[model samples]
Target: MHILNIGILAHVDAGKTSLTERLLFETGVIDRLGSVDEGSTQTDSGEIERRRGITIRTAVASFTLGDLRVNLVDTPGHADFVAEVERALGVLDGAVLVLSAVEGVQPHTRVLMKTLRRLRLPTLIFVNKIDRAGARERELLADIRRRLAPSCVPVNTVTGIGGRAAVTRPVGSTQEAAEILAERDDGLLELLVEGGTPSADLVRAALAGQCGDGVTYPVLFGSAITGQGVPELLDGIGTLLPAVSRSALPDEPARGAVFAIERGPSGEKVAYLRLRAGVLRVRETVVFHRGQNATYDGRLTALSVAGAPAQREAVTGDIVRVWGVPEIRVGDHLGGPGPAGQAHFTPPGLETVVRPRVPGQEPRLHAALLALAEQDPLIGTRTLAGGDTSVLLYGEVQKEVIGETLARDFGVEADFEPSRPVYFERPAGTGEAVEEIQRHGRNTFMATVGLRVDPAPPGSGVDYRREVDLGSLPPAFHRAIEDSVHLALREGPHGRPVTDVVVTLTRTGYSAPESVAADFRGRTPVVLARALRRAGTIVYEPCHRFEAEVPLETFGAVTASLAGAGAELRDTRRRDDTWVLAGEIPAAAVHEVELRLPGLSHGEGVWWSEAAGDRAVRQSTATR
Candidate 1:
C-alpha cells in the first residue's frame, strides 16, 4: 500500500479540526463524527485540549482508502503553538492548508504558506465553511490569489443552497485547469492543438508534478461541518497527491527522523519517527546522529502506528511511535549517519518566572518543564541559582497552556509572573585575562590559563578555540576547559546569555606532572568570568514584527498608538478601504496594543505579532 504522511494546517477558528473529523468519518476510520466543540476527536486526546477546544500540540491519526494509507497530522492553529506546526512539517510529504470562506486568508495562513513554499512541500488548499451565512467563495479565492499566491487553481466546486452539494470533474476539461496547463505544459498544449481533451490520468500526472515541485497549488471547496465536498476531497488526496515509492531493498539499513517527542500514559518517553528508508524492527539498535558528532544508540523495544497496537516492524514512509529511546530529541536523525536539519521556529521574545502554586513542588515543576521543553524546544526554561525558574513564551496564551498542562498531565499547579522581554549580552571590546598557578583557596589543582575575548559578528553565537600545546594538558582536561567556559558564559557579566563573541585560549602554563586535570575544571570558569567582566558587554532586547488591519478612519489613531509603544513602522498599504500597517515593536508593549485595539477601532481591528529577533537597546539602559 502507498503511504502518505500529510499535515493539516490553518488559522484558529478556520474549521481545521472539523475537517479532520469529517475525513476520519468519511473514510470509515470512525463510526461517527466527532465535534470539535466537544473535543472528542481521535487526534485531540488530551483533557486540556478537549476542555479548551484548542489544539495545543500536534496529533496524528491513520486511515486507509483503497490502495493508499494516509497518516494525517493535525497541527495547532494558534500562533502560540506554531512550534507544533514546525515539528509536524518535518515529517510530512504533503499538506492541506485550510482557509475559511467567511474569514478568508489570515496572518497565520500567510505564515504557514511561506513555510510550505520554502520547504517545497506539495500543498492542497481547502476553502472550508462554505455553509456559513457570510460565505463568499469567489472573493475569498481572489484574496488568496492576491495575498497568498497566484498558483491557486480550483480543483472542485460546490453548488445548491448553502453549498450542500458538490462534485469533481476531469481537470483537463475545465477551462481554468486547461488554460493553466496549456500555457505551461507542452504536452497539454499539443493535445489542445489537436482538438483532443486530456485524459484524467494525464491531467492528474501533470498536477502531481507541478504541485510537488511547488509550481502550483490545487484549491478545493467544501464545508467540513456538513460533510459536503468531503468525499471528493478525500478522493483528491488519494488520487492527486504524490505517494512514497517503495524501491528500497529489504536488507537496507533503516533511517528515520524524530520529529516529535511526548510522554506516554505509562511515563515512558515516546519519539514519533518518520521512516525514510528500508525497514525497522523491534530489538534493533538505532544510532542517532546530532550536533558536533554526537551519537546516541538505543534498542527499539516497541513500535506502533498512530493509536494502534504494537507492531514488530515498520516500513519506509511510516510514522511510527517508538519506545525505549529516552535520549532521542525532536530533531535527531537515526540510521543514516549525518546531522539532521532542524525546523525554523520563531524564538520566544517574552519570558516569565513559573512558580509552583503549592509550597514545595519546585523540583516537580522543573522536571515537568524540562520534559515539556524536550518535546517542544520553543518552551525553553532557565533555572537560577536560588532555584527560581523562568520559561520562554510566545504569548500569554502559551503561558496559560503551560500552567494548565502541568496541572492536567503532571498534577502540579503552577502560576507565571508578569512577562518581560528576554535579553542577550555581547562583548563590547577585546579583553584578556591570565590566571597564574596557585595552590590556595579554591584552586586546589595548580594550573595557569590565559584567554582572549573578542567580539563576533551579530548572530554568531559563542565560539571557543584553544591555541595551547597538546603535551601541556590531556584531551580530557582540554574538554573540561571548554565545557567550563560554556557554563560560565550561560549567565554572562550582564546576566544574560552571551552571544556574538569568541572565547579563545591563548596561553597555558602548568607543570605537566604537578597539575591535576580536575583542578583546571574549577579554575577555567573563574578565569573566563574574569575575562568576560573585563570585556565589557552591551545588552539587546527582543522585538516583534506586527501586522494589523484597521479601518481607514482609525488608521491615524492606530499608528499613533503603535508609535507610542516604541514601534518602527515598516510599510503601510491600503486594501479594500482598510489600511494594513506593518512594523517592528518592543515585545514588552505588545499586550498594551492588543488591549487598546478594540476600543480604538470599535472592535473592527485585527492584528498579530511574531518574534522578529532582537535589536540592541539604548546604550545607557541595561536589561537583565
Candidate 2:
C-alpha cells in the first residue's frame, strides 16, 4: 500500500460528500460517517461550504488503509467553484470522479474529465447512489466511456440496487475481467489471446500506464449511505492511487506561487502555494511577488500540514499554510522553502471587471475587492469606466460567496451588476477606411490609414498585425501604431472597449511630414481612431453552454424559457423523473433566465447553470 493524493469530484448533489463520509467511517478513519445534509461531515468543514451542500473549497484529510496513506481532497462539484478543483488538482496524483448510477454522465462530469486529461492524471470512477430510482449501471458506464476517457471500465458492481445490495469485483480474473482487459495493453491483448489471466498488479500497472498516457481510466460503483462496497473502494484506492508522503519541494530556496489565499475568522491569511522548484523553510525570509525576485522580503511565519499546525517546511507535494506575509497574492511567486514553477490560475470565462453597488463605499469597497482579487489573482479586476468596476470570477456562487465574505468579513454589503464581457468585433469583409487626425494645434495632424477588419474564429481572442512590413516603415514609427491600437481597443471606436473582432493596419501616413513628429506617434491614435470609425463594428455578448436539472414535466417549460432568452438549445432529456436541459445562452441573459425557470415551470425546476465562454467570430459594436 502507498500514500495517495486523491480528489473526490462529481456533479452537484451526486453523493460525493456521502461517498467520502462512507470511506472515512468504514476504513476506521472515523468512528461514524456524518451526513452532509445534516451539516456534520468532516470534509465539508466551512459553514458556507456545508450550508451550500457543496464543497466550496478543497479539504485535505489523512486516512490509513492497511499500509497506505490516503490524503483525500473533497472538492466542489459545481462549475462556478471550479477554481477549487483546479487548485486541488495541482496537488493530486489521482482522482475519484463520483457519478450517480441513477443519473449518468453530466456536464460538470465532462468538465472534470477534461481537467483531468489536461492534468494527465490517473483516474477511478465511482457510480454511486445506485439504490436511487432510475439506476442503470450499464448505460451510465457506456456514457462515461464515451464522454470521458475510453479506458473506463467498471471493476465493481452492486449485486442488488441500493441498501440491501452486496458489492462484487466484476473484473475478477481471466474470464471475468475480459470487459476491462480488451484494450488495456498489448500484453493484455496477448494474455487474452492465450486465454490467460493477468494478475491484479498487471491490471493496476496497465491502468496507471494508460492514465499516464491519457489513454484509460479504472471505474467502480457503490451506494455510500448503505456502506456497500466501502471496503472494496478503499482497497482499490490503496492499490491504485499514487503516494503523497514523499512529494516535497526540493531542499533549497524555491519559487512557490499562490493559487488560492483564504482568510479565516481570526484574521489570519492562509496562502496555498505550489512549490515551483525550491524548498521553503520555516522562519525564513522570502519574496512575496513574482516580479520582485531580487528582493525576498516576507518571512515564513509557520507551516501546517493536513489541517494541523506544524513548524516543518513545505515542498512540492505539500500544500501548506504560510502566515505573517503581507501583499502575497494568488499569482505571486515566492522563494524561500522551495522553488515552484510560474503558473497563473486564471479562472475560465472571467468577465474582467467587478463593480460595487454601495454608495460612497467606492474607495473602501474597491480596496477590499482589489485585495480579494490579489489573493486569488484569477479574480481579475479592471475599471472600464470612471465610476464602474468589474470583478472577474469563474462562477456565480463565487460571486455570492465573495459578496457574503465582503459583507461578513469586510463589513461591506456590495451587490454586483451585470458584466459586459469583452469581445473583439470586426467587419465581415475587408475595406479601406480613412479619418483625419486633427490635433487642433500649430500643425493639423490629418491622417489617412488603410485598415482592414476580418472575422476570427470563436475564442481565438484579439490579434492585431501590421500587413505592411515593419522594415518598410521606420522602426519607431511602426511601434507607435501598435501602442495606440491597444489604447483604442481598451477605449473602443465609439469610446467603449471593443469585443469580438480583429483590427489590422494595412497602411498609415500623416497628412504631411511636418504634421508628424517625423515618427508615427504623431498619427498613430488618430489613424487608429480613423479606421475604427470607418470600419464597421458589431456587438457580440458572451455565450455559455448551460445544463439545467428540473422536474420531468418542466422540460417543455425549460426549453421554452431558454428559447425565449435567445439561447440555442442542445439537448433536453429525462433522467429518472428529472429533466436535464442543455443549451447555450448569452452570458448577460443567463442570470435572469436561471432565476425565472423554476418559477415559470411552476416550482418544478431546481435550476443551476454552467457557462463556457462562446464568443462570436465577428460583429459590429452595439451602441454603448
The top-ranked prediction according to lDDT is: 1
Question: What's the C-alpha lDDT at position 212 in model 2?
Answer: 50
What CA root-mean-square deviation does each model show from the true structure?
A: 3.3, 6.0
- Please give the lDDT score at residue 576 for candidate 2: 83
**What is the Cα-based TM-score of model 1?**
0.89
For model 1, the superposed segments whose C-alpha errors exceed 4 Å read 160-175, 178-201, 246-251, 307-310, 336-341, 426-473, 500-510, 526-538
- Evaluated with TM-score, which candidate comes out highest? 1
For candidate 2, write residues 21-108 as lDDT tens digits: 8888876778987888889998888777777777777776777766655677888888777666766676666888888887678777
How much is 121 displaced in model 1, in angstroms?
A: 1.1
The TM-scores of all predictions, comma-separated, are 0.89, 0.77
* Worst lDDT 10-window in candidate 2: 337-346
lDDT of each: 0.83, 0.67
